[model samples]
Target: MPLAIVHQSYGRFGGAERVALAHFEQLRRMNIDATLFWSGLVTPGWQTRLKGYDIRTIPSTLPTPRNLATMIRFLRELSRYDSIIIHHHVDPLLALYLARNLGERTIWYSGSMFELAWEKWITGEDYRSISQTVKQTGQEYYGKTLSSLVLSNNVFDQTVRLARTVDIHAVRRYSKIVANSKFLSRFLKRIYKLNDTPPVVYPGPDPMLEQLSSKDFTGEGDYMLAVSPLIPLKNVDGMIQAASKVPSARLVVVGEGQDRVSLEERAGMLQVPLFLKGNCHSEEELAMLYSQCMFHIHLSLYEPFGLTPVEAGLFKKASIVTDHGGPPEIIVDGETGFIVNPRDYGMIAKRMKELLSSPELRHEMGQKARKRVLEKFTLERSAKQLLAEVES
Candidate 1:
C-alpha cells in the first residue's frame, strides 16, 4: 500500500520538514511507495532545498474547518493510500477529517506539544478557551472520531482532566501514535495520556555532513556556530544573551526567521559581534560553517528533535545542547557537550568558557559526539525503525 507523509506546509526547510522529507526518501529506499502531502504553498527555496519526492499541495486552512468539502474530496483521492503519518503539532483536527472518511488509517506522529506554548506566546490565551466557535468545532471533531478508533484506549481521560474538547478528538482518533523521540514518547503517555505507548523513531542525519573535514573550512574557525530559526521559542535570543556575557566569544547565527530584527538589535545593544547568516543557500555553505566553527551551540526552550547538534556532531564539532526535550537522547552531558538549564545564560556562558578556553577538551568532545551519533542515530537506522512501525 502507498504511504502518505503529511505536514501543514513546506514554506520553509526547517528541522520538522527535513524529518518529514527524510522519512519519505528513506521509506522509498526501503521499496515502499511514499508521497509527501502539504496543505499550503511550497516556497521557491523549498523547491530548491528538497528533491526526490511526489509532492502534492492542497488548499486547506486550519481552525476554520471551512474546507470540509475540500478535506472530504482530498481524503477520497487518498483512498488508495493505506495510512497517513500526520506531523501535527499535537493538534489532531486533521486526523478527525481522515477518520470521518478513512477511519482507522490515521497515524498521528506526535513530535512535541510546543503548539500549546506557541498559542500562549502568540495569543495570550490557552487553545481550549479561545472562543465558543473553536470549542464547538473541537466538540464536533471529537464526536466524529472517537467511535472510529477500536483500541480499548483511555482516549478521554487526559482530555477530560485537561478540560479541553480538542484534546479528546486529537488523542482518541489516531489508529496509531508514533513519537519522534524518547522525550516525546514520555510526553505522549503522560501529558497527552495515550493508553498505548508510542514508538520512538529518531530522525535521520544528512549524509553529506558526515564527510566534512577541516579542508572544507574557508573561513576563520574562531566563532561558535549556532543554528536556529531566530524565533522566540527557539530561544536563540538566549544564545545572544549568553554570548554577550562572554566578552571574547563571537556567535555566528545560521538561519533566518521573523525574529531577526529583534535578535540583531539585542546583539547590537549588548555590543556583541554577532554574524547573522539568514537561510543558508546550500549544503556546501552550511558544511563550511560547520567545518570552520570552533564548536556548536543550541539553546532552544522546547527543542523536539534538533538536527543542528546532530549535524554538528556529523561534522565532528563539539556541541552544547541547551534544554531538556530531545538533546538528552543525543548529547551525553559533559562528555559530548554539556546540557545546561533552558534560558540560563549564566550556565550557558560558563559551559561556553570551559570548552572555548581549552582546545583539547573541544576536540575530545567532538570526537566522542561523532561516535555517539554513529552508534545511536543515523538515516538507515531511523528508516528501518519507522518503516517497521508504519507497516505493523
Candidate 2:
C-alpha cells in the first residue's frame, strides 16, 4: 500500500512545508512508497527543488454547497491511498472534510491553530469561551448552533467558531493526531478534551544543514543572527533593544515582513547597528550566517515549534529563545541555550552579555547544542517515529 503525505501549499513557505518536504525525501531514501499531495501554486524558488517528485495538486478552492460533486471526487481520490498524513494550517475546511470522511485512514499532523490563535491575539478576546462551548456542548449542539451563539458580526468570534468546529468535530475523530510540540499538544488536549496528549513529532532542519561541515571560528562572531519574519508577533524590536545594550554585538535579521520599516526606524532611533537580509531561502546563505554568528535569538510570541533554533543547533550555534513556546523544550537552559521572557529585553541582553563575554562557554554550549540536535532532532529520527506511528 502506498503512503500519502498531504500539505496545504507551497505558495507561502514556512517551517511546516520544509518539514513535509524533508519527511518525503527521507522516506523515499529509505525506499518506502510515498506520494505527496498538495494544493496551491508552487512559488518560484521551490520549483527547481521539487522537480522530480510524485506531487499531485488538489483544487485551490474548497467545495461549496453547490460543488458537492467536486468534494465527492476528491474524497474518492484520497481513499485510494493506504494511509494519509494531512498537514493542517492553510486549509482547515479541507482537513475537516477529510477527517469526517476518512477518519480511519487519516493521521492529522497539526502545526498550529493559527485561525483562533491570531483571532485571540487581534481581538484581545478569551479563547477559553470557544473552548468551553466545544467541550461542554459537544459537536452536535456547537456545530449547528455556533453561529447564533457567537457574535455573527465579529470577525474574530466567527473565526473562533469555525476553528472550534473543526477541533471538536473533525480533529478528534482521526485515527491518530500528531502535534509539532508539547506546547501545542497541551493546547490541543485542552480544546479537544482528549484523554491523552497527542504525540509530538519535532521538526528537524533540512538535511543539507546537517551535512554541512562545521566551520571553526577563531573567536566568537561579532553579530547575533535571527531568522524570522519581521513582524510584531516575532518581536524583532526586542532583538533591537537587546542589541542596543551590547555595544560589541551587532544584530542581523534574515527574514522580511510588514514590520520591516518600523523595525528599521526603531533600530535607527536606538542607534543600534541592525542589518536586515530579506527572505533568504538558500540553505548555503543561511548556513554561512548560522556558522559565523555569535549566537541565535528567537523571541516570537507563542512560537509553535521554533525550527530556527534547531537549524542553529545543526550549525553548532547556541540560541536564546522565548520561554513561552516550544524552544524551552529544545534548548537546555544554562547549558545548550537560555530561555527568557519574550517581553523582557533586559533579561535577553543579560543573557547575551554572558555569551559575549565567554568564548569558551559559547563554543562549549554550541558543541553540546549540536550533539543534542543530532540525538533528538534529525530528519531520520523524526521520519522513523512518524512512520512508526502510522504503521501502528
Candidate 3:
C-alpha cells in the first residue's frame, strides 16, 4: 500500500520542509507510491519536481480555525489514506484524533522538544484561557479541542513538563513515534513513561549542500554567520554582545522573525557590528555566504539537531555552537568546531576570536567538519534509515 505523508503548511522553506522534500524524493526513487497532503500551496519548484506524484493541498488559514467543524472536516478527509505519517509541524493531538477513527496504522515524526514549548510561548496569550477551560472541563474535552502537539525546545526539564501535560495515551495509540534525535527520544521516554524503544531518526541536509561545494566565496569581509530565526530563545542579542568584544569581526544574521526589529535596535544600542541579512530563499546565495564566512555561530538555547552546523560543515566551514542538545552530536568539540555555554558571551567571543586569528586551525577544523557530515549525516543515509524503520 502507498504511504500518506501529512505535514503542516507554514512556508515552503525551512528545515522541516526540506526534510519532507528529501523523503518525498527518496520514496519516489524507490518506486513507492507516496502522496503529500499539506495545508498550504507548494512552491513552483517543488511542484515541478513532484509533477507525477499525488500531491494535495487543503486550503486553510494560517492559524487554522479552532472549531469542531474544522476538525471534523479534516478527520473525515484523512480517512482515505491507508497509513498516515505526520511530521512535527502538524498537531499531534489532531493526528491522534483522526487516526483513532481511521484505525491503528499511524506514524509521527518529532524534531525537538524546544519546538513544542516555543509554539506555546508564541501563542500563549491566545490559548491560555482556552487551555484552562478545557482542563476544567475534562481530559476528553481537552483532547478533542487542543490542536498543538509538540512543546518547547529550551530545556530538558521544560520538555518533560510539556509532555506530561499533554495526553500520552493519545500519542502512544499510534503505531510509531519517531524522534529526530537521541536526546529528544530520551526526553519522550522520561516524560511519557514509555519504554526506551522509540525510533530516533537524524535530520539530513537539503540537496543544496551538494551544489555548495562548487560555489566560490567572493564575500570580502571579516565576519561570521548566524542563520536562524531572530527569536528570544535563539539568543541573537547574545551574539551581538559577543561581536562587540571583537571590533574587527562583524556578525551577519540570515533570517526573519518577530524579534528582528528588537534585535536590530539592541545591536544599535550596544554599538555592535551586526548585519541583518533578513531572509535569503536562494540556495546559491546562502551557499556563497556560508563559503565566505570565518565560521558559523549557533547560540540556540536548546536545539534538537541543528542542520545549519551540518550545512556549514558541508561548506568546509567551522561552527561554534551551544554546548548542549544535538550540536555536540555533530561537532566534535576541538576537532570540528567549538561548543560553548549557550549564554556565555565572553566564552563565545573568545572562541570566535580564536577561530578568526588562526586560519590554519579553521581550515583543519572545517575539513574535519565536512568529513564528519559526509560519513554520517547525509540524506542518503537518513533515507535508508527511514525505509528500514518503515519496512521493519
Highest lDDT: which candidate?
Answer: 2
Predicted candidate 1 versus true structure: per-residue lDDT over 1-392, tens digit per residue:
78887876323456776666666766777888888776543435456646656788753534446676676677787787988778644234565566556657877776665353334533345433422223333334344344223111354334433434455555666688888888878777775567877888888675545554435466438899988776666777888888888878988988776678888899899988888988776567788888888899987766667888888887778888866688878898889998988678899999889988999998899899888888878878887887788789
**Alpha-carbon deviation at 138 in model 1, angstroms:** 17
Candidate achieving higher lDDT, 1 or 2: 2
Which stretches in model 3 have alpha-carbon errors above 4 Å?
A: 10-12, 41-48, 59-82, 113-167, 217-221
Greater TM-score among 1 and 2 belongs to: 2
Q: Candidate 1: list runs displaced more than 4 Å.
A: 40-52, 61-67, 88-92, 114-164, 211-215
lDDT for every model?
0.71, 0.77, 0.71
Report the Cα lDDT for candidate 3. Answer: 0.71
Tell me the deviation in Å of residue 386 in model 3: 1.0
Q: The CA-based lDDT of model 2 is what?
A: 0.77
The TM-score between candidate 1 and the true structure equals 0.82
TM-score of each: 0.82, 0.87, 0.82
Q: Give the range of the ten consecutive residues with the poorest summed lDDT in model 3.
A: 130-139
